[model samples]
Target: MGYALTFEGLRDLAEGAAVLGTGGGGDPYIGRLLVEQQLKAGRTVTIIDAAELPDDALVIPSAMMGAPTVFIEKLPSGAGNIAALRALEAHLGRTAAATMPIECGGLNSMMPLLLGAQLGLPVVDADGMGRAFPELQMETFAVYGVSGSPMAIASDHGDTGIINATDNRRMEWLARAMTIQMGGASYISDYPMDAATVRRTAVPGTLTLARRLGAALRQARAEHADPFQALAAALSGTLYTHGLVLFRGKVTDVDRKTVDGFARGHVTLADLADPRDQLEITFQNEHLVARRNGRVVAIVPDLICTLNSETGTPVTTEALSYGQRLTVFAISTPDLMRTPDALDCFGPTAFGLADPYTPVEHLTAVP
Candidate 1:
């Protein structure tokens, strides 16, 4: 069964998407407001489970490209989303039977939902990354052998272009170039595939997972229970099942900069109970690494997120501050991301870090 998306429903999805985004994925608030505007305008968004899609169905994966911070200064044109979707449909010579998110984090998590609601289409309850990533080529679709193009990029200014690349890697290369020329941020649609390929490549149920997790947090808050515990319980069996609270602390420092069209930065949290036990996080749009007490604890593919220690609201990289009290947690990534090929493409090495990849389960293992 599918659920209709509403403003109240968005709170759950936003909170859950924030957890999935892992300190990246642009601000969920912005995506929620944008979508709420459409909903208020009478657009209805229905979330469909991946299992409901027929094997022969045509599915399109959609997302936002470029810097998340850019969207803050320059709002999205809104029309760019369906413009790219329709353009891709034209290129494929087939209308999308349904659409799905490229990732279940940040803005792209809701981008497809917005497109689905506006187009009066259903959004598959799955996504490429169960969590968010910075680059396009790191998706489950790309690692699983889906071609990234023929793709489309569109802007609110009536600017649109279609691109055809031979491989996923080249598709990102070409799209990055076009995104910069058009503006810093734009909507992208690509990796069109049949439902069979999608079932194999996509992170099934992540959209609904995001919503449920969001709802869990909301319910916990309303009931006056420990939201952090509720947060862990909500993710008990997903790919991110190995949930662990790394530390609760007050932010002590933040070093951030925008580089190569990405937000690259680090945040330091000093132990709230004891300043000596500290956690430091490094991010490239998404949180890539987490170190506790000067020992590496959580790395990429696994999830690393920081939430308001008291209220449990997520803090995005762009919204990070030095004085905020926060609780940091880690969860295991899907097994699909642990394979040799998947690791080679998205592991710590790909992010230019030298640490051999270690799962969070082992790092947080009890002695």
Candidate 2:
């Protein structure tokens, strides 16, 4: 089905990205605004089916990378996105025929939209993973032999780097180091793939799915229904839990320092649903664990999403602070996201937790 993207269509798409982000992908608000701005400026991107891509089409995944907090403080100039893509094109000696989102959650979902509109390339309505994972290598493309290397990163400051790593892990490290130097954020274009590789590796139609999920949530609320329930219903999943958001206050304490080039920090949650139920969440750019009263309630592989209490919007780890009333929502990952290979890429041990991997359903089981 050929679909034209409208403002209303974009809102739904962004909302879907938030849901699929599983609490770690950055917020979609900025991305939404960016795409909207492009559309208003007479720039509307097209979405092409993955099957339509040429067998030799050079495809790249374009996205914004950094702490969402930094994004709000230092707004993007919108140049980094296209710059990265163009740099990748020039480096590989081949022009890209199309662009796709690396992942279709959070800010990343709309990243390619701006570039696609500006360059007049069709945005493939698919992504590497159906949901978001924190690392560059934790993608289906990597598993299926797509080299994230041969990519490029560009900053608004007019700096760019070609990332040619032996593996995706090295690529993540190198990219992280470069982003810190570029002032905590940069736009990257990666996964130089021919259409054949993209077809085999990516979860096609993710963009379309995101739009459907987002629209369902928004429409449910507008019609006086529960948005959470609407989302759960649309995905054939359930809202596992709803708990008080413990952090919403000022930063009473922020012990932050760069480690291996990552902005690492731990924040305390005080004004939570339970006054005596203080919690702490630790992170390395993305939330890794949540502990309530000294017990680990959530960890990697299982999404630990936080949302504003009043609005139920997803919150990025970088945006967490004290005195902000938030509600944490846990949803079961889609079956595709629960693959053993996928879990290994983002398991508890992957984040340095000593415990073995346990499904959220097991944790939530009646004891």
Candidate 3:
């Protein structure tokens, strides 16, 4: 059985995915827009169980890799997201029986929907990382020894290349260079695997889980209950902290530059309550560090999400600006993220911060 992804569906699913992003998944809004736009055009996305795939089924995961900021300005042109699929098929000499999301958050989640609708392929409901993280190697593929290499990447400019690196890390290096050369936006098709490999490594039913989380939040809000509370209940997740809107302002200052293929930036936020009190957020592709009142409140591996004070929608790190009125929340990471390997991939040092990674409970301790 398959379910169609919808705008209303994405709202809750995006929210849930962001919470699971652990401070690293690119904004879910971009993926939502891509998927919702296509769905509204009468395109349909179908999700299938991984178990249903045949042993010889060629499954390729497709996604965008590079600075999220670049994605907004240098958006996918010529169906850039789907280019990877075609590139991969050319390299493998066989058509993919299915497409699956590499991870479950933000852009990763919905791109599959868009690709599936465009190609008439079914999207498997399972995903590699139950939550979002920084590197390509952080997914279950690493656990299954699935190499991300021998992959294909393409851009809006109609340029495509296949990378056959020794391992996943090399694939990241090569893809980073390609993305930079392509103007900071490139889609990749990778981690070719058989059905058994896919089932053994991935978090089963993650797509279904994303949908359930989305539906639960929508239902709760409709019933006039706390949506966040409902989300916690659904994911076996814990809610940490919710703060007031410190600033409601426009992006007056943005310092962004790409170094070694990373989109790094600092966003200066002016407080709406007190103009003199300014806040600054530093990011590397994803939100990495946040500061307010001369104190560091949130850091990696603990989901730090910005929401509109009025609408309660998530704001992507790439979209953060000078004068946006937002209330930030700290959502604790799920158990899967706390494993030693998972933490090593995304903990404090992964973001290049000096502090040792601390458990989120310490920061968002309930009173």
Best by the lDDT measure = 1
Summed over model 1, clashes come to 1
Model 3 CA deviation exceeding 4 Å by range: 10-33, 212-227, 237-258, 266-281, 289-298
Q: What is the C-alpha lDDT of each candidate?
A: 0.86, 0.74, 0.69
Q: Give Cα distance to truth, residue 76, candidate 3, Å.
A: 1.6
Q: How close is each model in CA RMSD to the real structure?
A: 1.3, 3.7, 4.1
Count of steric clashes across candidates, in order: 1, 7, 7
Candidate 1 — which pairs collide? Answer: 25-106
Scanning candidate 2 in windows of ten residues, the lowest lDDT window is: 237-246
Tell me the tens digit of each residue's lDDT in model 1 across 1-367. 9889878887789878998899888887777877888899999999987778899899998888988788788877578899999998988889999999999998888888888888998999888888999888888888898887888989778788888887777888888888877777888898899998999998888987888888988988899888888878988877667777888899999998878778999999998679988899999999999998878899998899889988788888988988999998888888898898888878899899988899988987888
lDDT of 1: 0.86
lDDT of 2 by residue, 54-107 (tens): 788888889887766677678787888888998998998889898999988778
Q: Could you estimate the TM-score for every candidate?
A: 0.97, 0.86, 0.81
Best by TM-score: 1
**What does candidate 2 score on TM?**
0.86
**Candidate 2 ranges beyond 4 A from true positions:** 237-263, 266-274, 277-280, 292-297
Error of 1 at 135 (Å): 0.6
